[model samples]
Target: MENSQNQKQYWKENIRLLFILLSIWFLVSFGAGILWVEELNAIRLGGFKLGFWFAQQGSIYVFVILIFIYVKLMNKLDKKYGYDD
Candidate 1:
């Protein structure tokens, strides 16, 4: 029973983490790509329009930063939950 419960908890945590990461990914991609493009387009960075910047470069940078942040945060979360391997 204890082992089964632990397994379930592990799966739950994994699923939760996946969902959070996916949501962030979608926000950076689709959200910025479509939903927020107009607002972002008003701002400029160097020669690029903001929406174009995000659609082209900004999202990639944000994705990389997010990956590192996720790794660091997940490490902390793993340690907290005694799930670090």
Candidate 2:
């Protein structure tokens, strides 16, 4: 019974992290890149437009950062739950 509870808790943590990461990804890729694009374009990033940068490169960068973040977070969570090797 305790083992089952532990498993459930671990799964819950995983799902929660997944949700949080995906939300950020969506916000960056869709929200900044498309939804607020016109407003963002008004600002310049170096020589590039903010909206164009986000749509072309920023989202990809954010996704890479999110991957690292997920790995780091899951490692911490694993250690906390005695799941780490």
Candidate 3:
């Protein structure tokens, strides 16, 4: 019974982490790239319009970074839950 509860808590935390990371990815990719593109376009980065850069490349870069972050976070979470090898 205690083990069952622990598993539930661990699963809950894992889901929570997933939600947070995915939310950030969505906001960066969809919000900045599409919804706020015009506002972002006013700024420049590396000679390219910030909005255009986000639409074309920034989101991908952010996603990749988020992947690494998720992996690191999950590793910690696993260790905490005694799931790590």
Highest-lDDT candidate: 2
**Mind giving the per-residue lDDT tens digits that candidate 2 earns over 1-84?**
998888899989999999999999999999999999999999999999999899999999999999999999999999888898
lDDT of 3 by residue, 1-85 (tens): 9889989999999999999999999988899999999999999997999999999999999999999999999999999989899
Q: What are the C-alpha RMSDs, in order, of all predicted structures?
A: 2.2, 1.1, 1.0
Lowest-lDDT window of 10 residues in candidate 2?
76-85
Residue 44 CA error for candidate 3 (Å)? 1.4
Best by the TM-score measure = 3
> For every model shown, what is its TM-score relative to the native structure?
0.73, 0.90, 0.93
**Mind giving the per-residue lDDT tens digits that candidate 1 earns over 9-61?**
86788789879887988888888866899898998888988888888888898
Model 1 Cα shift for residue 82 (angstroms):
2.9
Give model 2's clash tally: 0
Give the RMSD in angstroms, all C-alphas superposed, for model 3. Answer: 1.0
| Model 2 regions more than 4 Å off | none
Please give the ranking of all candidate structures by TM-score, highest first, separated by commas: 3, 2, 1
TM-score of 3: 0.93
